[model samples]
Target: MSEIGATPDPGEIKDKIKAGSDRANALKAYVDTVSIKHVHRQDIEMIDLVVKTYELLTEIMKLVESKVDEIGNAKK
Candidate 1:
């Protein structure tokens, strides 16, 4: 029998990744829905920064997903 509290299964890791990606996508959608014009000029720069950060985060998630795929393939 397998030992208890062993290394996590790849499937579990993938599930966590999917959950995180889903949340990130939801946050991105929320950010995209905010009207730029509604933001005061003084805070516009901050808003722009936030949007860029979110874009970068989305890219990072894609990279992570690719890595996960690589791991799965390696095990096959």
Candidate 2:
């Protein structure tokens, strides 16, 4: 609360998003150039499968998050 009208301090939220984006970019870059020379073929295959599963999970999370946002906005 404030005496009159005042803007909120949104810098922390913005910084968090920027940090997340930076981390995502770094992970993408590393995944792009990742190799598995020391690991066996089956182990490498399992790693690839896990990566694909994670990608699918991320996609589904985006859809659910958007639906939640829609519901929240509808209430307003």
Candidate 3:
């Protein structure tokens, strides 16, 4: 357990992000199974937005991981 108001460890955050990315990939796979023409316009739009959001999150996580590596190296 962690103390209230304390920041989470970077490694923990990365683990969580990885789990989330896996979930997002699963969702994308499900989305892919359905035909876009059969789905409602709004639903298709929402799916597209979610996919884009996940892509951005993946990019951000890569940058964060790089920064974490840099920080760790600096400390060495």
Candidate 4:
């Protein structure tokens, strides 16, 4: 293409590219934080496994609340 009547400013183009990269990096980091890729087998009975998993989830919820509190405190 050779219709070079007007072109985007180089600095603007560079800034846009940098902004896109920054957004991509932030998204990747967020995804990494939530990605779980390991599942090890535990030889517990099904009912016991369900109860234990539920308990573990409760504990994790408490931990998540504490983290949110800390982050909120930091923001203030």
lDDT scores for all predictions? 0.76, 0.58, 0.78, 0.51
- Tens digits of lDDT, candidate 2, 1-76: 3235654234443444456555655655665576666778886777677567657655655565566556656666
Q: Lowest lDDT 10-mer window, candidate 2? A: 1-10
lDDT of each residue in 1-76, candidate 4, tens digit only: 2247854344454455556555655654554464244433442344345555555655655565566556656666
- Stretches off by above 4 angstroms in model 1 are 1-7
Pull out the clashing pairs in model 3. Answer: none
Sort the predicted structures by TM-score, highest score first: 3, 1, 2, 4
Report lDDT (Cα) of residue 75, candidate 2. Answer: 62
Q: Pick the candidate with the highest lDDT.
A: 3
Q: Local error of candidate 2 at 14, Å? A: 16
Q: Let me know the TM-score candidate 4 reaches against the reference structure.
A: 0.41
RMSD (Cα, Å) of model 4: 17.2
Better of 1 and 4 by lDDT: 1
Estimate the TM-score for candidate 1: 0.68
Worst 10 residues of 4 by lDDT: 35-44
A best-first ranking of the candidates according to their lDDT comes to 3, 1, 2, 4
Q: After superposition, how far is residue 17 of candidate 2 from its true place, in Å?
A: 14
